[model samples]
Target chain A: MDIKEYKKYAENRSKRTSSLKNCVLAFIGGGIICVIGQVLFNLYSIFTIEEHAKLLTSASLIFLAGLFTGIGWFDVLAKIFGGGTLVPITGFANAIAAAAIDNKKEGFIAGVGAKMFIIAGSVIVYGVSFSILYGVAYYFYLLLI
Target chain B: MKNIIKFPEPVSIIQSASVVGKLEHEGPLGQYFDMYEDDIYFGKDSWEKAESEMCRRTLSTLLAKANMKYIDLDLVLAGDLLNQCIASSFGLLDCNAPFLGLYGACSTFAEGVIIGSNLCSTHQIDRCAALASSHFCSSERQFRFPIEYGGQRTPTSQNTVTGCGAFLLECTGYPPYITECVIGRIVDSGIKDQNNMGAAMAPATVDTLMRYFNDSGKSANDFDIISTGDLGKEGYEIACELLYKNRLDMWGKYTDCGMLMYDYKKQDVNSGASGCGCSAAIAASYFIDKLKNGCKDILLIGTGALLSPVSVLQKQNIPAVAHLIHISNSRN
Candidate 1:
């Protein structure tokens, strides 16, 4: 068969991942992480202002994710939770920490320092650019109003 | 003229050994492996070094098991799933033999055997060592995400096996000789998904199998076993169906090293095991034993997807190759 035909044939034969199952798992896993964040936010709010509590909650989650990555638990959790473990502050933290840990053996400069952002670099770049664009757009609208 | 090369005199596989990491040691074919390290690092500081160390141990075990020394080898043909094939070069650094580095992606092991056997059959080398290795951690960092990255594996994705296999081939020795081999040609099936490697590689497997059968005039029933290197589940199924459509029935005699490496029900390996080491370890340990134990003839086709990380990122289609090696118990 031709390449095009073979591609279609292979695609039909290969098993696809269940989107419904993944969505359910992601919903539950992401919900649990958010709940943890909410709990931390509430606990911090008991002793601090709303702004400080938010910052503290983010910090705590980042710390926990980095710790779990170091202990090699983050990957284990990731296998089960899939995208649920991602799309969170903790996931971003885990990505940085994991890259750092993976490259530690190569030393500080070329290894950990340079590659620490390998996975998160694209996210940061796009995220910051989009935010700046939104900020400029919002400023123009405010001036017109 | 056929592309197949038939040896005037069979090159004997004198000895073989396999070394694997913890996950592979816990696999279904765990007991068949010669040695395994509980530590994935193999007591090294990094995953790359760990892979090199695995290769070193595999060669050492092969030599030790054969009651031979490194000095006895005239040439060492080795490769791995590492950049520039550093795993083989650095791992076999201490071996005083002449070395030839090869790159065929996951088909490196079979490529090594084909070249090594050709050299041995031509009486150019008295003894040659063929080696290949791959480590999951190292491969992941280079090809996919970081080891600790929170990413989900697609159902069609395969787990790279952390293992190494070494085969000691001589011009003359015991049975289970390399009688014939066919070097594969690159074939592209327009598969862009890196996660579904099995699908990308299945067409190449079918291409090579068809060529081998057509040229050699051999039927599937003639061999005791016909196995592909690391096609995993999706590729294996696709290959079977494709071959069946072409009127070549490979149902009962067909199997894949990727499928044999792990237990589908128990192991969380989505599609199955892969990597260069997947086939190398299985062929070295399990199939070698089977050949030794009265299995008359066996055909091992090492399948490889030749897509680099850069190429895949650029959205290029994956090109694949499958090399065939005909191993038989008798020279005739």
Candidate 2:
């Protein structure tokens, strides 16, 4: 077979996924996670320093996501809920926790720590670089004004 | 024709066994496997070691079922989804027979049977054992990601099977013999996506099937069943279309070991089940059981993606191959 023809066949033979279903699941699941975070923030607001409420809510969501990942519930949710579980801070926590749990057999330092960032590594890299760029831009803006 | 090997002499598959880890036992073909593990690790500390243990169990179980000892085999053939075929080397360390460790990725078992059957038929060996195994944990860390890495898997991604299969072949057994094998050429589709292996591997599967049909002068409909290993759901569909385009027209009576090895899409196995264990375990356990139960003929095509982490990092395209063995319950 011609190389071009073969490439076309390779690319096109498989079935396409249902995007409509995925969008629906993501919308619903993501809404629920956001609601939980808001509830946590409200609950913490009444008890602790009002200034710490946002931090408390983030910490609570991360903790819960990590816990669910430890028990293998996060994967089930991720598979079914699609982007719902992954569009929040809870997903970030799940990534770190999942890597740690998966590599537990490989050992703490080399296996877990080394591979813990494979997926999340790109996110961290971009985050830091963008923050630095924004900081420099803000400083320049202040001087120019 | 040059790539096809014809076995004119008589040989037979004596017995076989399949051993799987925890998650696989919940799949559709769970009942067909000889045994399954409740523990993912198979009682080993490391995932690599556990994979080795899986190979060991299948080897022993096949021998026990055949009422034979390790010393009875003239040679032992095995492989795994690892860098060095270490699982087989470490797993069968105690066997006194000479070992030939092969690496055909997921198709290692078919490669084993092709070689083992030829040896027995040619009178070079009276009895030979062939086994292939893979573990999800060991394979994922080596080939793609750490199990703990929370990356979103594509719909095309397939879960590596945590299992192994063993086959004992001899000069003459109760039934079924491997008649011919069509060794595949390396077919590269220029696919660089490591996550979508099913698509990457489909072209090679088509190439081998075409070669087999042309060289053997047999139509695709001639076989009662045609099965490819570890192509999962998407790869299987693609290969079917490619077959039609190539003029073989193998549209029906086709199944994939990767799909059948599982209960079929119930597990969140992304695309489907994959790895060396997918074809090996399913062929040895499920297909053999079916043959014994009156399913007469089968074409077991072992397909594999020849890609390494280094190769993928170097931006090399994944080249794939498929080797086929024509098996039947009768000597006719």
Candidate 3:
């Protein structure tokens, strides 16, 4: 079809497109993303990793997933799974991955490295800000105790 | 828990204007933006930049009309449709408002209002502003892709509104006092159609409304009107059906911003509803018009689908989000 005809039909095509293939793929992709978490849960049974350490592993896995997403691989996976790749914690990993990768392509100092941490850095700042507030509140609670 | 958050002084909204639908002479180019050298939303210019500029310009005109000193104002609490709020950051650079950038997709306007109202109520700043802006071209490119990239659109897909809307969320001790935030609910109906975002997001609207109704100890009938952000026609009907199916009654004076703007027949407004800007523009412009002319209490429900085109293309069903803010002009 010509471009104009394509534009007219595109809307209809999007609706008619089958979700079955995508849905199955998404389920599989999403399941794959969570497979690591499932393994870590099993490892928790085998070896007594501290709860915090276990949590760190989960976070790290998500971060690693995000790192893959940044490289553009995860997005492709996300596309196939629809919400499967996206609905999980792995989606966030993809966002960070995409940002860092985009920035890196520009060059590290200003482009890649500087830009990589923009959103993540803010999240850290906000995290610290709230943490300090909680710490102060805890100190007051201790004084009352 | 009581916490003190400092903010800049409050400033009145001296003036405001919104551009909606297609412009007369602009041709395919919907609106003029000073931020873009080319002013084309579909080109290589970052969509994040395009949307931000839309918001900045809208706010600038409003501020300029009010003749308020930007330096005198306390802070700008603003949000956008971008995932991490890249548009808002770039948007504020032009307006130069000290900003606390926020993200809630379509809900950003109400989120801005709630925060601004809280700061204003605390008398932290004599006057403060909360604003949310969205643009279709830029949003599509960032989250979906360039419009020209020409992927298929669904009949369920509403054309993304092209303009920006800004609200002056002031704590002018403006009589109504914004005493409470009856938070909107987030419901996700497992509908995977990205084209009919309104239908997918309707469940979130219903869930949030139900929660708000329960929390506020109020019924849907309590408010003068309960308006939704987008949801167009199909979503609106779906929402009604879903509400009825759940045995919840929300039958009166409810409307959607998508349905309100543009004539589908005349303008060929293909999809039933669309993006974050649809609600932002409606709330800031249309609703504000009503409020200025003494409209009473209202519940504005803003909805957003968190899914991107990339995710959809990969066959991901959309997950929806919504937030509700109850605005009242009543005095004690």
How well does candidate 2 score on lDDT at residue B3? 66
Fraction of true inter-chain Cα contacts (below 8 Å) kept per model?
0.85, 0.37, 0.03
> Any residue pairs clashing in model 2, and if so which?
A98-B148, A99-B148, B28-B262, B28-B263, B106-B276
Report how far off residue B277 is in candidate 1 (Å). 0.8
Report the number of the highest-TM-score candidate: 1
> Best lDDT goes to which candidate?
1
- Each candidate structure's TM-score, on Cα atoms with residue i matched to residue i, is 0.98, 0.91, 0.61
Cα-based lDDT at residue A130, candidate 3: 100
In Å, residue B32's CA in model 2 sits off its true spot by: 2.4
Summarize candidate 1's per-residue lDDT along B1-332 as a digit string, tens digits. 46888987899999999999888888889999999999988888888889999999999999999999889999999999889999999999998789999889999999999999999999988999999999999999889988888788888999999999978998665787999998999999899999899999998999899999988788999999999999998899889988998899876899999999998998899999999999999999999989878788999999999999999989999999999999999886
> Highest DockQ, which number?
1
For model 3, what is the error of residue B216's alpha carbon versus the real structure, in angstroms, after optimal superposition?
3.0
User: Least lDDT summed over 10 consecutive residues: which range in candidate 1 chain B?
Assistant: B166-175
The local lDDT score (0 to 100) that residue B251 gets in candidate 3 is 79
lDDT string for model 3 (B1-332, tens) is 21122223322333344544342113222332222223444333555556666666767765765577576567788777676787777767765666898777666776776677667666776566666766665566456532322123445667676666665555554533354554544554556666667767777887777777655567767777788888877778777776787777877778887787656665655654466666766666666667677777777887877776567768765677777777666532
Misplaced by over 4 Å in model 3 are A1-145, B1-48, B175-179, B309-317
lDDT comparing candidate 2 with the true structure: 0.85
